[model samples]
Target chain A: MHELTVDLGDRSYPIYIGEHLLGESRWLQPHIPGKQVCIVTNETIAPLYLSRLKASLDGYQIHTVILPDGESFKTLEVVNRIFDGLLESRHNRTTTLIALGGGVVGDMTGFAAACYQRGVGFIQVPTTLLAMVDSSVGGKTGVNHPLGKNMIGAFYQPYCVLADMTLLGSLPPRELSAGIAEIIKYGLISDYPFFEWLEQNVDRLLVGDQEALAYAVERSCRNKAEVVAADEHEGGIRAILNFGHTFGHAIETAQGYGNWLHGEAVAAGMVMAADLSWRRGDISADELARVRDLLVRARLPVTAPDDMTPARFVELMGVDKKVLDGRLRLVLLEAMGNAVVTSDIDTDLLAETFAACR
Target chain B: MHELTVDLGDRSYPIYIGEHLLGESRWLQPHIPGKQVCIVTNETIAPLYLSRLKASLDGYQIHTVILPDGESFKTLEVVNRIFDGLLESRHNRTTTLIALGGGVVGDMTGFAAACYQRGVGFIQVPTTLLAMVDSSVGGKTGVNHPLGKNMIGAFYQPYCVLADMTLLGSLPPRELSAGIAEIIKYGLISDYPFFEWLEQNVDRLLVGDQEALAYAVERSCRNKAEVVAADEHEGGIRAILNFGHTFGHAIETAQGYGNWLHGEAVAAGMVMAADLSWRRGDISADELARVRDLLVRARLPVTAPDDMTPARFVELMGVDKKVLDGRLRLVLLEAMGNAVVTSDIDTDLLAETFAACR
Candidate 1:
């Protein structure tokens, strides 16, 4: 097992990445300070991993809230079920909530932990590659509103994140591709060497090679942990981590969530961002092409939904959280391995990129 | 006018106590860093002070979400209205949320702000004495659940708290009494001198003496601020601040909320706590009598509702946020002026106090 710490000072926690780490009491027990444990998993995951996890938590007073699986279920109302189970089971403030599913389950469970009795201990045991590489590492936990994705949430850190690569053996092909989108994001944002490595080993990740998957997860977490530690609240440098997210959120909001996977929309959104960067004379056409090529090789979408228009995208993006003082702050590439968050977007260029990408 | 700071390190904010501070832009504008402002108030408060508060932000883009007035409306569904309004108006992450009512409005707005786009700027403009002296000053913000009172919330601080004493001119007598319950709590928990002062000036406060009310508000805020600063997340000493809350929450939950005003429930709960303290030999019967006498003088309840039984109270209190590992941690008065949180409660004595108080 490989251990990486997201150093957030007093709120710092560890991310354990390796094969067959789940069902190990050693990895899960140390973080749970109290005797009561509430494991929140989705219906799909419960059928597969719940019993194994429950077995690991042998002595504790255990409770489980199994939710229906999907991005559509990521709402305040759905998250309330976890709250309902918690209150019904009489889970106390000291009780630790274990989020044992994909990103949706983790987000809702982490958010439930955040608001449950004004914060409690949370452990993220991410099951999907998407969660292992992205959502589970950062403290961004929340639900979606009809108006926007992650519109209601909190920057609440978890006690620890346990990412067992063996869990990915059962992931659907599309979900695996979706996870690679975020993996590619880490390379594009700040790590040039990792970006180059991904170019050579993108095939290895696509085929579910455990070694490559572990390396990508660990590297992505390391990059994310650094950004989060420096700016836990997204005050400055952290906004760069949202590279492609502003456009991706608009796509997700426009397509009605669940319809388009977050990473798929982000895959396409990254292309639009790169195109805009090329138009702004920040990066070469070759670099923009290379960005799209990596995502294409990983079998992720490279364009917005055919029905979405530039006007619709603009309207939906207006309500995105990234907008500040009525200006849309787009995270664009200054270079292949660099990202910059700027509100000063050339309207003509944005329209051009939207038209081209769609 | 008096200014007191809730020293929560970087998240610290000032509590301004004065006459006519609400209609002034000078106090409101300094805290609002963005151009957009969403004023969240209830129907009763909107008709009264919303316009006055709006008038202060002459140059800013303003929005209002007027909720139905009452504790019954303090829920996730109602709080969603604030989120809907914020998104509908395109209030981004930089926008500030101004809570322009009592504790219900404050709690809902603060929770909305805390969750809106993963936290945003929030300011508390309290109109009720209960809010001004207690809820608004502390960072405890959330909506109540059917299972328990304040079972879901965030410890998110406001940018600043503005308590306009003049706003109290229109407060109902019963509401004023509710506010007094918390002020008396400060005296019993940490400030005996303030407790003694309340004994002499309770009548003046009841009659709306501005000078007496101002002194009480400042003193209560100081006491709360000190506790909150020392332990912001209620680790140890801060639990004492919830001296009457566990018992009080049971009363509120048992009555189905909004029936017994929060302060009234707390008043009765404090009396029961004092009775329990006496039984435990922590305080004298005379001290318990003094506690009851002060609440009665303030026109607050000195006993739990006649309909509630010990078993029901026990059931409700068991689900309270204070419960740790199924153990009920009651904040009992160690003396007239000091409080201690103990899980080692004598159940027999607890039932005796519940029987005696009811």
Candidate 2:
């Protein structure tokens, strides 16, 4: 197993990445200090891996809240059901809550732990590649609102994040591609060689290459942990970590969440960002083309849907968290493996970029 | 205006206590830097004070979401409405959320700020006595779940808290008395002299003595701010602030929230706690009498509602945030003003205390 640390002083925790780490009972034992443990999973994941996870949690008083899977159900109403499970089981602030599914389950479960008795213990065992490489490491836990995705949530960190590579073997190709989008994102934001590495291994990753997958997950988490530690609350520099999210979240919002997976939207959003960057003279057309080529090779979308108009994008993007005062701030790539948040885009230029992406 | 800092490093905020604070542009100015503002006030409060609050936020573009007033409406479903208002208004992370009512408003708004776009800026313009002294300062933001009060929420603090004492003049006598319950709590937890001062000036407070009210509000906030700064997440000493809340929340739950005001239920819960303390030999009967007498003198309930059974109390208290694993922990008075949380009372003794109080 490979271990990476998210240095958050007293709240600091480790992320364990490797093959079949889930089968290692040692990983589960240290995090589960109390007798009462509530494992929150989803219907899709529960049948595939619940028994093994439950067996690892043997000798503890366990309760399971198996939610119907999908981004569609990520709402406060669904999160309330988690409160019901904890209360009915008499789970206290000290009780450990284990999130054993994808980003939706991890986000909901982490949020449930954060709000259950003001806050409680949470351990993220991310199953999907999207979660393992992106959402799972950060303490950003929340549910979706109809008006926006991840609109209602908290910056509550987990006790640990266990990303087992064996779990990736069961992920569908479409889902695997979605995860690749985020893995590629890590390269774009902070790491040049990592971006180059992802460019080379894109096909291998899609084909379920264990070595390539493990390296990508570890590198992504390392980058994510550093960024999260530096700016836990997005007061300043942390906004950079949200690379293509402003445009991505708008796409997710415009499509009415669940219609587009977060990573797929993000993949298209990155293209939009690249287009905007190219228009702004921050990146050459070649760099933008390279970004598009890599995403295309990874089986991710490289353009916004035809239906997503510039006006619709503007309307949806206005509600994004990154919008400061009223300006739409976006993370545009300055060069390969580099990005900067710019709110300086001209209206005609932004509309032109949106038009190009569409 | 008297200012008390909650001293939480970078997340610390100032609590301003004075008459007509809501009308003061100075308090609102530094906290609200952005052009967008959302004032969340309930229907009951909006009619009385919304315009005055809006007047203070003059230069900023402000939107209002008037929630139906009641503890029952303090749910995620209701909080979603606030999100709709912000999204509909195109409010972003820079938009400041001003909570303009009592505990419910502060909680929902603070929580909305915490969850809206992962988190945003918020300011508290508390009108009620309960809010001015206790709820607003501690940064405990959340809505009640059907299974538990404040089961869905965050520890997100506001940029500033503006407590306007003058608003108390228009408050109903019962609501005013509810505020006194928390004011008295600060005394019970850490200040014996404050308790004695209340014993002497309870009548002046009930009759609307501004000087007496101001002193109580300032003192209560000071006590609360100190505890919250020391243990922000209730990991240890902070739980002491919830001296009677376990029982109080149970009362709220058993009576179906809004049946008993939070402070009224807490008032009764404090009395029950004192009764339990006396039964546990932590305090003498006279001390217990003094506790109940102060509550009565303040026109607060001093016993559990007759309909509440020991079994019901046990069940409800079991779901309290203070409960560890499955054991019931109660904060009991040890002297005139000092208190300690103990899970050591005999079951028979606890039953006797419940039966006696009921």
Candidate 3:
């Protein structure tokens, strides 16, 4: 197993990545304070892997809460449902919650755990490739509000994360490609060699090559762990990890959530950022084209939908969490595998870039 | 002004207590980061003192959101209204949220500020004595859930607290007595000299004696600030502050939230705890009688309602935030002005204590 510590002092925890790690009860047993465990999952993942997980939790009293799959279900009401289950099952503060699905389950369960009697222990058992490579590792747990995505949440860390690569085999092709967008993001933001490596092995990743997939997940987690360790609360350096998120969040809000997968919106958002970077003379046109080509090869969207206009995009981006003092601070590319936060970009260039994406 | 620090390292903040401090713009102006300010107040306080508070916020863009009075409005829906007001008023991260009312407004606005764009700055302008002496000073911010009270929230601190003693003059007799319950509680749990002083001056506190009220508020705040500084997240020593809260929360939940003031229920709950402690031989009968006499002289409830049965109280207490591993840990008095957390009390004795209270 490849272990990466997300060094957050007392709140720090380990992210274990490898094949067949889920069956190893020793790693999970110590973290769970009691014999009673409640595994939170969804309709899509429960049917496929619930039994295998239950087998691993043999000595403990286990219960399961299966929610419907999708972003729409991530609400305060749904969070209450998890609380009801825990309360009804007589689970106390010592009881542990195990999130056993993708990002939605992990986010919802992590939030539920955070508010359950002020806080409780929770473990991430991410099944989808997107969650395995990104969301599951970070302590950013919350539910989406109608006003904005992740508008209601807390920065509560999980006790541990068990990223079993074997679970990725069950993910749909579209979902797998969506996960690649974030993998590419890690490389684009800080690691040039990883970006070049992805360019060389894009095909192998597409066909479910286990070795390539494992390597990508580990590298992505390592990159994320380092950034999180430096700034657990996005006060400064951590904001850089939000590359494309400003535009990506705007697109998600404008298009309405669940219409486009988060990674898909982010995929197109990255291209917009790259183009804007080139227009500002921060990066060469060649680098922008390379970014677009990579997103295309990964089978992710590279342009915004026609219905999304620049005016709507601007309005939507105004409410983004990263915005400050009415100025839209965006993470723009300095070059391939390099980014910086800047609010000095010309308004005309930004409008043209949004128009081009649409 | 009396200044006390919460001492939470970088998250630490100062609590300023005095009469007419709200008009002192010098203390508040430095914390207001941007040109815009949003003051959140309830109907009762708005009609009386909003203009005076607004006058202090001069030379800046100011807006007001008036909510209905009472605990019923302390919901996530109300928190959303504050968010809507913030968005509609174009308040940004730099905009400061000033909570200008009682406990309900302080809690909901603090929560609203916590969730707006992940978080923003907030200041407490507590009007009621209950809020000034307790809720407003500590950074414990959250709204009540239908299933339980304060089931969903975060421990987000404020920039500063403005506990203006002048506002307490507008409070009703019942509200003033309710605030005294918490004041007496601080004396009961941590300060013996304060307890003796409260016993001698209970009549003066009931008649709205300004010096007695100010002294009580300052001492209670000092005790709470010290506890919060030692255990910000309630990991250990902080649990002692919930002296009567385990049973009081049950009383509040059982009677329904707005029926009795929080301090009244807590007053009755503390009587029961003192009786329990006496029965366990941890405290003398004279000390228990003194506790009841002080609450009674202050015009707070010293007996439980007729509807509350020991079985029902037990059931409700099970869901309290202090429960751990199926055990209900309660803060029981060891002697006058001293307490300890214990789960070893006899069930029969507890039932009898409930019977006696009813």
Top candidate when judged by DockQ against the true structure: 1
Tell me how each candidate scores on DockQ against the true complex: 0.86, 0.67, 0.41
Screening candidate 2 with a backbone cut-off below 3 angstroms (N, C-alpha, C), the clashing residue pairs are: none
Pairs of residues at least 3 apart in sequence or in different chains that clash in candidate 3: none
Model 2's CAPRI class is medium
Provide the global lDDT of candidate 3 against the true structure.
0.85
State the TM-score, rounded to 2 decimals, of chain A in model 2. Answer: 0.95
Candidate 3: which docking quality band? acceptable
lDDT of 3 by residue, B92-174 (tens): 66788999999889988888787676678899888989998888766888887666667667777899888777788889999
Provide the overall lDDT of each model, using Cα atoms, as 2-decimal numbers: 0.90, 0.86, 0.85
The digit string of per-residue lDDT tens for model 3 on A1-358 reads: 7888888899889888888877778778878987889899999888898888888887898878999889999987788789878877867667899999999999989988876766788999999889988887768888876655676677889999998888888888999999999999999998989999999998888888878888899999888888888988788778778888878878887777778888998999999988899998988888888889998999999998888888788777763334534477789888877878877767778888989987
**Residue-wise lDDT of candidate 2 within A73-119, one digit each (tens)?**
99888888889899998786779999999999999999888888878
**Candidates 1 and 2: which is better by DockQ?**
1
| Chain B only: TM-score of model 3 | 0.95
| lDDT tens per residue, model 1, B1-358 | 8999889889988888888887788997889999999999888988888888988899999999999998778899999989999999989889999999999999999999999999999999999999998888778899988877688999999999988889999999999999999999999999999999999999999999988999999999999999888988888888898888888988887787778988898899899888999999999988888999889889888888888888788777673334535478888988988999888787789888888988
The candidates' interface RMSDs, in order, read 0.5, 1.3, 2.3
User: Evaluated with lDDT, which candidate comes out highest?
Assistant: 1
Lowest lDDT 10-residue stretch of candidate 1 chain B: B317-326
Q: State the lDDT of candidate 2 residue by residue for B1-358, as single tens digits.
A: 8888989999999988888677768888998868999999999999999888878777789899999998879988899899999999878778889998988999999989988888889998888898898888888998877766677778888999887789998899999999999999989988999999999999999999988898899999999898889988787888788888888888887887777888999999898888888887878998889989989998999889888888787776663334544367778888868888777667777778778887
What is candidate 3's CA lDDT for residue B342?
A: 83
Distance from true position, residue B192, model 2, in Å? 1.5
Descending-TM-score candidate ranking: 1, 3, 2
